[model samples]
Target: MQTSPKPKLLIFDVNGTLLNMDGIKTAINQAYQHPGAFTQWFSWLLQYSLVDTVTKTYHPFSEIAEAALQMTAASLKVNVDAVFMQDILKSMQQLPPHPDILTGLDLLKKAGYKMVTLTNSASAAQKKQLEFAQLNAYFEETFSVDAVELYKPHPKTYQYVLDELNFDPQETMLIAAHGWDVAGAARAGLQTAFIARDGQALYPLAKKPEFVCADLHELAVQLAAL
Candidate 1:
């Protein structure tokens, strides 16, 4: 069997991958007074983000986030005014990195891997979240789909990063917590690592990630072995 070459560029997915979303859950729970409101809001946010992408109509991720929250609230028969929605959206900026993120990033950095981020969040918002979490230093660069005006699971989103880095697809690996994001990178010919956070699973129809680890620290350890 031919061995796969070591990856040169490691692109990470932010949000639930590196940054924990518990803050979001808590905020939604408090504001909506509805059980599972966070899950529903997140689902709607993702759905609409892709809807915009597919329709070629772009809206800032924050805008979509608010809209999704409003929709989620309405579905649960909760009426949230604009001020309440803004407060929920603002919580996104204060999210902290997952417990294993710093250690995992240090392991990769010490191993001399080039790291960057590719997120669906707008560049400004992503930067603020990373900076707030103190994770900005670990990454060499950050890219956002806002640059391409598309969301993940779109082939072009992955292609944009590859083009910027000028690395062969086989020599780059995308690490993400979302199955759809991992599948998108894999479909774009990049190698993939799936960080399966709690309650997250890979899309069964897509190709499997080369590595599936429970947390970033574990994923880092596995990558270091390569």
Candidate 2:
């Protein structure tokens, strides 16, 4: 496999990449009293993200979460208070990182790579989530699509990270679990790494990433060799 020179900057996606949000899925199912409640909300979240990107409409990630939850509740024929929905959304702030994340991030830092987090989440929630995970110190910056009023898979969202960091896409590597995210970054000219967190499939027609690893630690080792 071809490898570029050492990366000057490493960008990570939050959900399903560093953090395991399966707890949120369980919470959603429990709160809605339905087995598919979590899947429903997740699908709606993606839908709204696409809508926001295409329409140039923006809402805080928390608001999107609440709105998606409400939609899920309505579809399940259940009634939930708006305040209660907000509480559930706030629970996202308490998610923890995967087992390999901190150690992998430590190794990357020791190898002298600059690291940042890029997420589609709102800034406040992303901060809270990282702080709770105790991995906040590993990153020099946390970027959210909230700044651009768009979501990932949108070229502008990835461009926002490059613009803020003032780094060329060629020198930056985007590490993500979602195929769409990796594909978008690759399209934007950033080298990409695919972390197979849940055996999720990549976009069949998307530009393939430079590397694929089972988890963050493996990705770190591959990067260290570059």
Candidate 3:
């Protein structure tokens, strides 16, 4: 438990951290004609996100979603239309929060921690997801890497949020369920809290998070204690 001095701003990753997107995984598989198609698409989505980031090419997350789906479909030897792909993405916007998210975020807000979301999704899409989960009001701001034309694991993307909020890296903590995101923030010189959702392993290339918890409520309690 490496506790930093009290944090002035808390930046959170949207997907997997606060929101429960398991349903979206089901929806994607159902939309595609394969059992593991959703997983393949998601993996490729990450690959493409990194490619776009490293190449300095920008694409909306929605576009990445579509491309990944198409590539996955191709790999599976199936064909899908743009309209069907759009449906899959629209379904993503309807995902609900994890069971403990609302109560936890409310508690943190009351504790005077400034909460903001930093996501890879586009601003409109991110807003729709948060709004659907009823988690929007708890946040001071919602940010998307789309504005910076890059994605996470890129140091520049994490830096963009700090720059936009006028926050010092040391004063802001990036909380996320994804280990790569934790790594990226750490590289950018921000403290990190890892919410261990889905039992994903930590990144080998990056420093471990300052705090690791089972979920957002546990993290909220820890942050409040600080």
Candidate 4:
């Protein structure tokens, strides 16, 4: 059997993958006083992003997020104002990285891999997230779909990164907590690693990625073996 080569460019998915979402999750749940508010809001955010992408229309991720928040509140018959919703979302900009993230990135960096981020957030939000998490310096660059005005799991979103870095699909690997994101990269001909974060799973029907690890630290250890 032919051996698969090691990846050169390591693209990371932010949000639940690298940064823990508990901070904002707590805020949303508390604001609504609803047990499942965070889950519902997040699902709506993702669903509508795809909706916009499929329709070839675009909205900033924050706008979609707030819309989701409002819709969730409406569904529950709870009152919410735009100002409060925006304040709740401001927590997203300051989310902290997971404990394992720094350790994992250090191992990857020492192993001579180039790292970057690909996120659904707007460019400004992405920058603030990285800076607030103190992870900006670890990455060579970061990408936001805001440029293409298309969210992830879209083939073009992955293509944009490949084009920007001039790396062939096979030479790069996308690491994400979302099964759909991993599937998208696989479809785009890139290598992939599925980070099995809490409450996340791979799509059963999609092609399996080359690696599936329990956490970023575990993924780093596995990749270092290569």
Candidate 1: residue 159 lDDT (0-100): 89
Candidate 3: where are CA atoms >4 Å away? 31-33
* Tens-digit lDDT track of model 2 for 124-160: 8888999999988899999998888888888888889
- How much does candidate 4 score in TM-score? 0.97
Write the residue-wise lDDT of candidate 3 on 1-226 in tens digits. 5667777899989888888879878867886767788779988998998998788788888889889988988888876788888888898898888997887887799899998999999999998998898887898888888887889978888788788889899998999888888998999999998888775668987887888888888888877777
Candidate 3 has which clashing residue pairs, if any? none
| C-alpha lDDT of all candidate models, in order | 0.89, 0.86, 0.85, 0.92
lDDT of 1 by residue, 21-99 (tens): 9877987877889768988999899999999988989999899998898788779988778887887777788898999
TM-score to true structure, per model: 0.96, 0.94, 0.94, 0.97
Once fitted onto the true fold, the runs of candidate 4 whose alpha carbons sit more than 4 angstroms away are 1-3
Please write out the lDDT profile of model 4 over residues 121-216, one tens digit for every residue: 998999999999999888999999999999999999999999999999999999999999999999999999999988899998887899998989
Pairing residues by index, what is the TM-score of model 1?
A: 0.96
Output the number of the lDDT-best candidate: 4
lDDT measured at residue 3 in model 2 versus the true structure, 0 to 100: 66
Q: Regarding lDDT, does 3 or 4 come out ahead?
A: 4
Count the clashes in each prediction: 0, 0, 0, 0
Model 2 vs. true fold: TM:
0.94
